[model samples]
Target: MIPIYKPYMPQNIGVEISEILYSGQLGFGKYGREFENKLQSFIGAEYVLSVSSYNIAMLIVLSTLGLREGDEVIASPVSCLASNQPFAVKGLRVVWVDVNPATGAMCPDDLKSKITKNTKAIFHNHFCGYLGDIESINAICNSFGIPVVDDGIEAFGSQYKGRKLGNLGTDVTVFSFQTVRLPNTIDGGAIVFKDKDLYEKALLIRDYGIDRTIFRSSNGEINPDCDIEVEGYAGLMSELNSYIGTRQMDDINSLLAVQKNNAAIWNDKFTNLDTINSLKITAGCIPNYWVYGTLCKNKTKTIKDFKEQGYYATGVHINNNIYSVFNNNVSLKGVNEFINHFVAVPCGWWFENK
Candidate 1:
C-alpha cells in the first residue's frame, strides 16, 4: 500500500556517501560547513545553522533567546508537538492561538488578541507547507516589538511573495530535514536567523558554547585553550548527514515540482466531490504541498476507503493542548474543527504518478 510519506533520496546518494567515507573525517567538519553555506545561499538567509534534528534546532533557537521562566509564547494549536513543546521545556508558558479555519494556520486577529505584557514571542507554523498570513502576523508582532519564530518544518521549498519561507521577515525560521521531509538527511534540521548577532550566538550554542576556531595562531594553527560562556547542547549535524543533505539539494527543485504537480492533480480531482474540501492557500503564497490534505465530511470513513484502495491516509498531528504537559483545556473552535475533518495523503516525491 502507498504510505502517507516517504523520504526522497537522490540517485547519486551512494556516491556522496562513498566520498565522505573515503575522506576519513566524519565529524561536523568540512561537509557540515559546506552544507550550511549551500543552504544559506539556497534559502537567501543571512545565516543558517544545521542541527542534528528539528527538536534540537528549536531548542537551540529558544535557548539562544534567553526567555525567562513563565514568559508566554503565542503559538497555534494546530501543529505538531515539536513546534511548541520547546517553549514549555524552556520554562515558558504557551498561549494557544486558534488557526484559520480554511488553512490551519495561526489567525492574525487571534494572535493580536492574545498578546499581553507576558507575551515574549510569537510562534507560527506553516502547516503542511501551506503558507500562512505571515506578513500580517509579522506586522502585528513588529508593532509590539515581539520576535516571531517560524516553525517552517514542512515549508523548506515554499515561497511567499517571491521570497523563500526561511528568508521571510521572521526573526528566526526553522526547517526540518527529517526522513519524511522534503530534503531528507536521515535526521537533521536548520535554523535561519535574521539577526547576525543571534546567528553568531546560535553557532556557539550548537557546539557546547565553545568556539573551536576562536584562538588561531598566525599560521592558522588552532589553540587548545577555549572559553565556554553559556550552557549549550551537542546539536551539531554530523558530516555524513550533511553530505547526504548537500547531495539532495541538487535535485530539490525537481522534487518540489513533482509534489506541487501531484497536489494540483488531487485538487482538480476532489473539486467536484462535495464530501471533500481542499485547504485554502493565502494570496501570493506558493506552497510545497508536503502532504496533500482535505477536510472530509466523514474523515473516518474516508481514511478507511483510501486505505482499502491502496492509499495510506491519516491525520497530520494531534493538537498539543490535549497533552497533559500543556494542560491547556481551552477550546479553540478552528482547531477542534480541524482535528476532526483533516486527513492527509501522500504528496511527496514517491507519489508523482497519482
Candidate 2:
C-alpha cells in the first residue's frame, strides 16, 4: 500500500550513525552544531537552533515572546494541534483566524480583523508547504507592533516569490524533521530567529538556561564558574539525530523536486475532474508539495476509492477549534469549508503510481 507520507533516508545514514556511536559523545555536541550551521546556510537564515521536536521548537519560540497570562495570540484554526498547542501551554489566549479557501493558509484579511491590543503574537502555518500571504500578514502585524511566528514545519524547501519560507522576514520560524517530513532526522526540528538577541537567548534556553560553552577555558579545560540566568528546558537535539539530518540535507533539493513533480502530475490529472478541486498555489510561490490535498464533492467516498486503489489518502490535520480543549466554537467560514471537504493523498518522494 502507498502510505500518505514516507521519510527520505540517505544511503550513508547508518555509517554516520555508527560514527556518532563510536565517538562516545552522543549529546548535543559537534554534530548538532554542524547540522545547525548547515541548516542556517541552506535556508539563508541568520541563526538556527536544532531542537528535539517541532513541538518543543514551537514551545521555545513562544516562551521567548515574554507573554503573560491572558495575552492573545492570533493563529489559524485550520492546522495541526501542534501549531496552536504551544500558545495554550504558554498561557496565551488563542484568537482563531480563518484560512484561505484555495491555499489553506492563514487569511490576511481574517487576521487583520482579529488583531486587538491584547494580541501579543500572530502564528501562521504554511499549510502543506503552500505559503500564505505572509508579507501582507507581517505588514498588518508590524503596524500593530505584534511579532509573527511562522509554523513552517511542512515548508522546509518551499519558497515564496524569491525568498525561502524561514527567511521571509518573520520574527521566528520553526521547522520539523520528524519521521514523515522531508529530510527526516528520525525525530527533530529547528528554530530560526530574525533577531540576534532572541537567537542568543534560545541558545541558552535549549540547554537549561546555562551556557555550556562558557564552561570551557582558553586551553579547552573545564571551568566551573559558569552561571544560570534564566529558566530553560532540555530541548536540544541529539547528536545522532543531527548526524542523520546533516546527511539528509545533501538530498533535500532532489527530494523536493520529485515531490513537486508528483504533485504536478496529480494536478494535471485532476484538472478536468469536476468532482475534485486541487489546492491552488499562489503566484510566485513554489511549494514543495508535502502532501497534495484536494477538496472533493464527497471526501469520504474519495478517500475510500483512493485507498482501494492502493493509495493512502486522508485528512492532513483536524481543525484545532473543533476540540473541546480549545472550547472555540466560533465560525471560521473558510476553515469550516476546508475541513468539511479536504483530503490529502501521498505526494512524497517515495510515492509512485501502482
TM-score of each: 0.95, 0.94
Off by over 4 Å in 2: 215-225
In candidate 1, position 172 carries an lDDT of 97
Best by lDDT: 1
What is the Cα-based lDDT of residue 219 in candidate 1? 71
**lDDT scores in order:** 0.87, 0.85
Clashing pairs in 2: none
> For each predicted model, how many residue pairs clash, with residues at least 3 apart or on different chains?
0, 0
